[model samples]
Target: MGMGMGLGLGSNMQQNNSKEWVKDASDAQKGVNEILSFEEYVALAEKRPCLECRPSCKYIKDIFEYFGKSPRGDYNLFIKESANSTAVYGQQRVYEHIYQNILNFTEEGFNNKFILLVGPNGSAKTSIVRKLMEGAEEYSKCDNGALYSFSWIFPIESYIKGTLGFERRGEQKESCSSQTYAYLEDREISSILSSELRDHPLLLIPASKRQQMIDTWLKAFPSELETVRKSYLYYGDISKRNRMIYDALLQSYQGNLAEVLKHIRVERFAISKRYSVGAVTIEPQLHVDLRIQQITMDRRLATLPPSLQSLNLFSVQGENAMANRGILEFSDLLKRPLDAFKYLIMTMESRTINLQGILTELDIFFIGSSNEIHLSAFKQHPDYYSFRGRINFIKVPYLLNAEEEVKIYNDQIASLKSKMNFEPHALECLCLWAVMTRLRPALAKNYKDKKLGELVTTLNPLEKALLYSNEFLPARLDSEEKKLLKVSIQDVIREFENENLYEGKFGISPREIKQIIYEISSKGLMVTFVDILDFLNKFIDRKNEHDFLNIAPQGDYANPVRFIELLKDYQLEIFDHELRDSLNLVDDRSYEGYLIRYVQNITSLIKGEKIKSQITGRYEDIDHFFVKEFENNIKLKESPEIFRSHMMTTLGAYSLDHPNKKIVYTEVFTDLVKTLKESFREEQKKVIVNIAKNLVFYLSEVEDPEHKRSSSLSEEGRKEIEIVLEKLQGKYRYSQAGALTLARYLIKEKY
Candidate 1:
C-alpha cells in the first residue's frame, strides 16, 4: 500500500512539473528577440510616460531615486542595497557635488565637461564609477529606462527589387503589404548595418523636422517637452557613419521620408559593461581610445544597394564611440601620459571627438578618477589651467565616520563571517581606530566663539569619534555645550577641508584593514577584538612602510599608538556593559520605566498635586522619598526645586519640537541616563565580578579536560554562568572561545 501511494505521488509530481516547464518555455519565448519598428518605438514611448528623451547626464541622474535625507541631512541615493555589499557610505557630499554638476550640465543643454573624482588612494573612486555603470546597465533593462537605436536593413536583392521600384522597367510587379522591413527574417535580408556608436533612432529624422514632430507628440505632456528640448534629441546630431547612411537613404528615396523610415529598424538595446556597449572604462594607456575603420569593402557589405555602396562609408569602433550615448569612465586618467588624453580638452568642450578626419558628435557623461598625488603633480604642469577649466574636480574622501566605516568592513568580510567565528565589537574596534587616524584635532583658534572652541579643543580622539558617529556626546560637556557641538558637527568636519592636507587624505584605508582582517582569520582561531588590536599594534610598529603613519603626531590625530589606547579603553567600556547585561538580574527597560515614574512623581510634587500611579491606577500624593532616592542615585548636583524646573523646561522644549510623539526620556536626557547607567554598574559590580570569575573558571575547565571542575561555584552560580555564556554566544555573536577570551580579559583588566 505504501509503494502504491508513493507511485501515485510521483505521477502527480511529474504532471505538475510538466505544466511548469511548459509555462516557463512559453514565458521565455515571449521575452526573447523583441524588435520594434520606428512606429512601434514611438508608440511604446508614448505609452510609457517616463520614457522621455534625455541627455546622458539627466538620464544617469534619473536612474538613482532620492531615498530622502540621512540623519546627517545628506541626500541618500539608496545605492547600498545591503550590509553585505560594498557601496558608497558616508560620501553623500561627493554625490551631492556630482548631482549638482549633472544638474548644471543638463540645464546648459548638454554635458560638455569631464567630472574628475579626485581623492587619495583606495578611496572608492573606482568603486563609485563602477556602481554608476552597474546602475546604468540595470536601468536599461527597465521599461522606464528603455533605450532605442536603429540599424540599416537592406532587403535581399530579389525582395527589394520587387518593392522599392528598383527593379528593371520590364520586370514583373509584386505587391508588398508590410509598411516596415523591421521584422524581416534573416533569409529575406542581404545585410544589416548597425552603428557601434548606438545612435538614437530619432537622429534619422532631419534635424530641422525632428524637434517639431517631437514637440507635437509631447504637446499633451507639456512637462515632458521641456525635458525633450534639453536632451540630445533636440541638440545632438548623428554619428559620422550614421549620417552617411541616413543621407544616402534619403537621396535614394527622393525625399520620401516615410519610404526612408520603412527600412529603419528601431530595436531596444541594453547597456552592458561586459560588451562595452554604453559603459566603457578606459584604462591608463598610451594608445588612443577613439578610432575609425573603413567598412565599405568588407564582404558583409557586398550586398548593399548601389546608392550606399557608392559612398565611402566608415565604421567608428572605439571606447569613445561605444560609450557615445551613455557614460565613459577614464580610470586613473592622470596615470596616462599628457598626450594620450590631451584631445579630451577639445572633446569635452565641443561634445565631439575627431576620429581621423570624421567628427562624431557624442552624447556622453564623461567621468574620470585620479589620486590627489597625481592631480597635484598635474597641477604643477604648464597646461593644468587649460585642462582645469574643462574638468570639474569632485573630491571623494575616505569615510571619517566610524559607524559608516564599520559598514564597509562588514560588507567586505561578510563572506568570511560564515567560515570563521567573529567576536562582537571586533570590527567596531578596527573601524574606530581607522577613523580616529583620519581625524584632525579641533583647533581652538579655528573657531570664532572662544567658549565653543575651548569645549571642542578638550575632546580626545575617542570622544571625537563618538561625537562624529552621533553615538554620544562627551560626558564632560554641559547640556548647552553638547547642543553647540551637535550643531557645529558639519563645521568641525570641514575644519581642514580647504587645506591641501585634509583629514581623510591620510589614513589607514578600508583596503588595508581588510588585509589585516584576512591575516587574523588565517590563523584558524576565533577572531576577537584582541586579535585586531594586536595586529594593528604590529602594523604601527612597521610604520615606515606607510607614509601616513610616519607623519608627526598632532594632539590625538596622527598618533596611531594613542588611537590604539583609545580603542582599548572604549572596548573595555563595551565589555563592562556586555558583562553586566549578561547577568540578567534586571531588565534594561525597567530602568527607563523607573526614570519615567520618578519624573512623574517629581513633577506632581513640584505642583503640589496628586499624581496618577501607573502601577495602582489611582491618584496619590507625590512620592517625595522615591524621587529623592532616584535623584541621589543619579548624583544630581542641583537643589530639588532647580532640578525640577530644569526637567520641566527640557520636557517642554522636547514636546514643542516633537508634538504628538512618544517621548524617549533616554534620548532627551542622555547625560542623565549616562549617570544612571554608571550608578547601576557600580551597584552591580560585585555580582558582575562573580559572574565573570565563574565564566572564566568554566571556560578553563572546558578548555582543559584534565582540569577539575571548580567546587567553589554554587549550583545557582553554575546555572547563571551557563546562561551568561549562552547569552554571550547567542545575543552577542561570540563563539565559545571568543567569550572565554573576553571573559579572561575583562577579569584580569576590567574587573
Candidate 2:
C-alpha cells in the first residue's frame, strides 16, 4: 500500500484486472466499470487498438473524432461510435478485413455507398465497428523508424440520429440508431508542410505484410512498447506494467525476468530500428537529439493498387476531405444494389428523410448488411418491404463442416486463454458457451454468430453453462430453485435404485423430490444423470411388477411388458394433472393452473437446489435458456388461435417483463380456452384422456439436448415439443407457418 510513490502512477495505479495484460479477458473486463472520459478512453484504446501490428498515425483517431464530418466536402459520412469493447474488438486477423470491407464501398462510381450492418440484438457487429475507431488513430509504423500516422483528415460528422438519405428527392428513412453526416470540415493547420501531405489518405494494407511496418514504428518510440511489451515486446502501456506484474506474477517462473527486460531499454527513452518490417533492429535515440523528420513513404500496400503515391496526415486541423468527397448518401434500394455498404442497418432504414440541398451526389463505401425487414423488431412497417433486394451479400455462412467448426473453436479458445491470460479451462468454458449458444438458438434467443470473446468478457463459464444447460434439456427450468428440483429428480434415481424410499416403486412425489434435492445440495455436489427416471418409479409401489436384476431396458427404468405397463399406470396416477398441462391436455383445465401445477409438481419433487443447478450447469443463466421450446409442441396439433394463445401465455409466464406474477388465465390464453372447448366436444372422453396422458408422459421426458442444430435438432429444444405433439399427430408438423410461429416462441422463451 505504501508503494504508491514508487510507481509514479500513484498507489491508485495498482494493477487491477483492466490494467493486467497477462490476465485473461474475464479478468481484464472485471475492472471495466471505471469511469473514464470518452477522449481519455479512446486515447488509451488507440495505444493497444490492434494486437496485430503498430497502428498508422497515433493521432489518426483524433482527426476522425474531432473533424470527421465533411462528406468528401460534398456529403456527410457518419462514423459510428461504439460503447462496448466487442463493437471494435475482433481477432487481429479480421481487423484488416473489417477496414477493407468498409473501404471497398468507396470504390469508383459506386452508388449507395453507406453501410448498414444488421443482426439480432447482442450480436457483435457494433463492437467490431467500435474497436475500429478506437484503434484507427495509428497503424503499424513504416519500414523506417518513423511512426505511421493515420486519420481521415476529411472532417466527417454524424448526428447520432440524423439522416441524409436523399435531399433533392426528399427520399430518406428516419435515422434508426443515429443520423451521421460525415463531411470535410476545412481547417488551415497542417502537420505536414507540403500541401499534398497536409491531409490523410485512406489506403489498403494487407495482413501479412503489415507486421513489418509495426516493428519499425514501435522501435522509434519506447513509449508505444509499454502497452504491448508482453505481446510485442516493443511498445504497449499495459505491457510495460505487465512486465513489472510479470516479474511479480512469474517471479518464480522458469524464464528469467531480468533476461526478458534486459534489452527492453527501460532507461533509454527513444530508440530507432535499423530497418522496419523486414529491416534489422536499431539502437536507442536520446530525447531532442533525434529529429522528427517529414519523409515520403514508398511502402508496399497489398489492399491498394500501384497508382497511389505519397499520403499525407494533418495533426492540428480537420481537412476538407468531406468537402471534396461529399456525403456518402443512400436511399432504400429495396432489392437491387445489395452490395452497397449495406451493413448499416442499425440506423436509417424504413423511416423517411428529406435530403434536399443537404446532399448532392454522395459517394462512400457501404459494407452490405442484411436490411430484410423484421416485423418483430419494427412491427411490420408497411413501407419497408419484407424482402428487400438491396445491398450485396458477403457470405459468412454457418460453419457446417465439423472440421471448420473445430478450427473456429480452437481459435476462439486460444485467444481467450493466451491474449486474456484466462485461467486454465477458460477456453473450454468459452467454447462451450459459444457452441451451445450457436447450437441452441432458442437458448441464445436466436442470436446467430457466436462470439466467444464477448461471452467470456460478459459472464463466466459456470453461468454460461447454466444458461445453455436448458438447451441440452427440453424442459423449461427458469428459476434457480426449479433447476435444483430437476437435479433432485436425478438424485431420486439414486434413492430409487439404491435405497428403498418408495413402497419399492418409483412413486416420486413432488414433495419428496423437493426434499431430496434441497437436502443433498446442502451436502455438496448435485445429483444429475439419465438415471433420474429410477427415482420417479420409487414411489410407484412396484411390488409384484418385475424383477430388478433383469435390468436391460432401453429406458432408465424398465420391467417386463406387463410390469412396465403397471409402472406407467402408477406414473399416470401420480402425475395425472402435471402430464395434462404439459402435454396440451385436451381438457377444460385452465392452461395456467395446469402449467403451474405441472411445474410445481416436478419442481416440488426435486429439491430446489438440484433444480437451480440444472437450470444452469456452470453458472446462473440469467438470459441463458434451460428450456426454449416445448410450448410449440402444442401448436403442432392445436389450431392457429390455440397455438398463438399458448405461445403468448407461456411468454407472459416467463418473460422478465412479467416475472412478478402468474399470467396463465390472462387474455393471452383465450384462444387456448376456445380451442379446448372445440376439441373436447369433437373427440370422445377416451381420446381426450389419451391426449392428456400422452402430454404428461412426454413433458416428463423433455430435457435439453446436449448438442446443437447441425443438419438436425437432436440436441435442439424443438424435440421436447415434438415429443408432446407426436402423441397427437404421430409426426412433426412441417408447415412453414407453424415452424415460423414456433420459432418465434422459441426465441422469446430463451432470451
Per-residue lDDT over 84-165 for candidate 2, one digit per residue giving the tens place of the 0 to 100 score: 2322211222333333433332221122223444432223343344333333212222212122212211111242123332
Count of clashing residue pairs in every prediction: 0, 168
Runs of candidate 1 with Cα error greater than 4 angstroms are 1-33, 45-52, 66-86, 163-178, 220-223, 584-590, 601-632, 636-646, 684-704, 707-710
lDDT at position 1, candidate 2? 56
Worst 10 residues of 2 by lDDT: 263-272
The clash number for model 2 is: 168
Displacement of the residue 181 alpha carbon in candidate 2, Å: 30
Q: How many backbone clashes does candidate 1 have?
A: 0
Which runs in model 2 stand beyond 4 Å of their true positions? Answer: 1-108, 111-113, 134-136, 139-359, 366-382, 385-389, 393-423, 440-751
Q: TM-score of each candidate? A: 0.88, 0.21
How far off is residue 729 in model 1, in Å?
3.1
Residue 693 of candidate 2: its Cα lDDT? 42
- lDDT of candidates 1 onward, in order: 0.78, 0.29
